[model samples]
Target: MDIKTATALHRLRLASIPEALSFPALLIFGTGFRLALDYDKLVMPLGIIHGVLFIIYVVLLLDVWNRAKWPFKRVALFFLLAVLPFGGLFGDRILKREEQAGVIAARARKEGTVNA
Candidate 1:
């Protein structure tokens, strides 16, 4: 609940939004390009971009999971959401709600601990 944890969570939450969206976008574009289109040139670049975003998402997810000390169920849910199309939106909503509620920061403040 300290600042470090809060910051890491925030970063992860932000990163996840784009990462989640990119996957679906890539899928849609890929399908469209493959069928009824001659724009095959776009596939590789988009695939690479989505791949990188996915890697970033996984790394951030791990870092946040470790810092937050979240339960296994929560970690699994996030991981599952990452692979689903449009799932990132749901994840973002949950994270935003939790962030606004100040769940972690409030707990840290109540404990009278430093921002570490």
Candidate 2:
């Protein structure tokens, strides 16, 4: 992998944790606030927030998919994780493992331990 690709992988790994977390939190908070408090005032902001976070997550996912050359099924699974309750955590774990593996591969390639 080139320098930019490796750096992008690290950036994606860092962003995945929070991106995975935000949706669940938003789900709980947004629903509760909508039911218990003001509708248009408070919860609306949360909807917007969720939309923004979701967009960011998708963009990051696409970038990772392109850099990593993930298959269609893997990409779909990750996308599904974004919508499923608590799925983001699972996705985060998978992404961390993937990043670690990628780092290992990159290092091996750099040291000529593995054939390119």
- Candidate 2 clashes between residue pairs 3 or more apart in a chain or in different chains: none
* Predicted model with the maximum lDDT: 1
- The window of 10 residues in a row where model 1 has the poorest summed lDDT is 97-106
- lDDT per residue for candidate 2 within 33-91, as digits (tens), equals 77887564656677778778778878887887897778999989988887776677778
Query: Which candidate comes out best when scored by TM-score?
Result: 1
TM-score of each: 0.83, 0.81
lDDT of 1: 0.81
Give the runs in model 1 whose Cα sits over 4 Å from its true position.
Answer: 103-116
List the RMSD of every prediction in angstroms: 3.3, 2.2
Cα lDDT for residue 63, candidate 1: 90
Reference-based lDDT, each prediction: 0.81, 0.75
The backbone clash count of each candidate, in order, is 0, 0
Mark the 10 consecutive residues where model 2 has the least summed lDDT.
Answer: 1-10
